[model samples]
Target: MKEYLALFVIIAVFLYLTYTIASLPGSDGLPGNGGYISDEVWYVTSARNILHDFFKTPANSPYYTTTLDCLTNESRIVKEYVNINAVTVTGNVKCYIRRGFPYPDKEGILSYYNFEHPPLAKYVIGLMEAIHDEPLFWRIPSMVLGAATLILVFLSARRVTGNLWALAATALMIFDNTFRAMSGIAMLDIYLAFFTALLVYLHLSGRLLGVGTALGLAASVKYSGVFPLFGLAYLYGRRGVWGFVAVFLMAMSVFTLVNMPIAGQLGIQRWVHEILAAISWHTTSRPPGPIASNPLDWLCMHNSFALYTSPDIYASGTPAYLVALVYALYKRDDVSILYLSTYGGYWLVYLLGNHTLYSFYTTHFSPLAHILIARLLSDIARRK
Candidate 1:
């Protein structure tokens, strides 16, 4: 009963926090006062275009260009065109771009949408748009996924540590400004983080099919999810190659399925070409301007990315992460080692690869960090 109560309270708190943050006023492409910007404009609109094309035409109809056009128009509008500018009495002007709306000029020059990231997340957001084309609706998925992630974090921690530690870890994550901010946005990173945490939890439980499904879903949300495969393989390879193969096949299948609508429209050869082009664009893309920081800076919390201003949310866990690192170093337990290795593998990719890295990218590291910190606290309490 005590354990159940703890879980219940944690979940209730998480849900409350997530919903509150997600409900904060933001513009979902509708023109209005007090409208806030979001990356959802691109994702929600692209999903809208894809769904529109998917329904209006047959399954094999060319949605590639349509999706690309939607993405391209959104990019151009947000970057090149500014629709609204507000001036303060002090003679300062703040500019706001119109987002989350379909492209008005059909004849405008449409650049090929990069289609750089995987499509699963956009599809989910698009589904929300289908239900209700509102900004709040678009962000619902993130809020739900964020809450689910907290549950998984608690479960994973409880499995290795205790209920008290699980509760502490969940609370730490729940209160994190970065987690709260991401939970409220229509962005891919939060989804990626949720699936990644689920993958770890499922893997730990020895549920092979669930592992594969989680792994597949994670990668489908964002390619960065592939990083966890290495850690999983290394930790579980002693069982044999069959499990790894299952993970591979399932992940590939999910990836292929989610992309089939767009791929079928483009044909195999053209689809391959588009994917390679996206890779090239990612590799060659310039540094992420002044606001961006390298992997080291993110881990050290030297320069966390600012996601919002009015409430002052940054993509950072800071001293909490530092605490986790110290505890992991001291404990060296199986759970600690597993998370440390997985966390290290994920960060190492960013460290070696050259792309605009944001602090939010560190969101994936939060669950492991929380678990480790919880373990440390649990250990100290036991010793006392």
Candidate 2:
């Protein structure tokens, strides 16, 4: 009990310091700098668009046909050839007359963003907008999820090893400057980390049904939820057909239930149509600049420091890094660290090929590294 209390106090202090450091003029704002990034602009617009159903407000709408239609269209002459500035069309344009985002009032302007990622993220942002109608409001939930991710790390570490290591793991995640920033922002990556850790915890604790439900929620947040699904499938590969079926049904049921309201309100086909429209926007979206076109461009760009660095920097060293890490922990094969590494590494591979990959993509890898680093630290302590 005394040890747990001490751990809690230490964690609380780190969290406070983290928040304080992040609050420094340029910290709390978001993706690129103190201000929100382009993706955040889209997320905010999408959230506002969702409110069009209830309030008819267009303040944050991403569509060109809304508040800024005239300007969005006029400026769109340049947007057309610019690639990154292209607009997306949605069924909501006709049904709600809500128009496109960012450049909401323009007719031909379209978003380069696509719905392929998953609708749940938009729904989350939208729900927050419904309440506060502010970007900061939408950011609140991700912050909570981020803090919860730390709590889960602590708990999971204790379960896998013991309390001492759990406290150390939690501390590492709290101080890891990048994770600190990502958790405070409104993006989906932190949420993805939260869900991945959650699903793993539930599965380890013998709550298979909870694992399915959690994964479904995770999938709804981002396409990366598929990584957790794969992890579970691999873990349960030989458990039995019935086990697989039960898990699948639980996950699918939760996913469908959450999506039902949106599908019903928009019409199932129209909902799917908007989703497809979003996907097309993303895939065809133009490269931001030459520096953004290649993964190596990350090195030269100085302003947005977060966008450039990540575990991929270690890819060339994977033979020495991941290989060594794997061999050293060979005895912990049944542990969650292995699964976290597997899923995180899998995403890193996909990101390497994505010419559009940004800094936040590294969030996908942090949760896994958080645990393993703690384990490594523990191993060193034991040797000492």
Global lDDT of each candidate: 0.66, 0.54
Please report the candidate that would top lDDT against the real structure.
1
lDDT for residue 105 in candidate 2, whole number 0-100:
27
Clash counts for the predictions, in order: 0, 30
Instruction: Put down candidate 2 lDDT per residue, 267-332, tens digits, no spaces.
Output: 889877876765454445355752232222222322233321321111111111242245335644
Measured against the true structure, the TM-scores of the candidates, in listed sequence, are 0.80, 0.69
Q: For residue 111, what is the lDDT in candidate 2?
A: 31
> lDDT tens string, model 1, 1-384?
787787778778777876766776664222342233355545555566565564342111111223222343222222222332211111111321121233322222132232777788877876776666556777889888888888888888888888888888888887666676788888888898898788868877888878778878877777777766776676657778888888888888877887898798879898888777666655453654536666567657867777666666677755677778778777866556656765676466555565566777767667777877778888889999
Error of 1 at 318 (Å): 3.6
Error of 2 at 175 (Å): 2.9
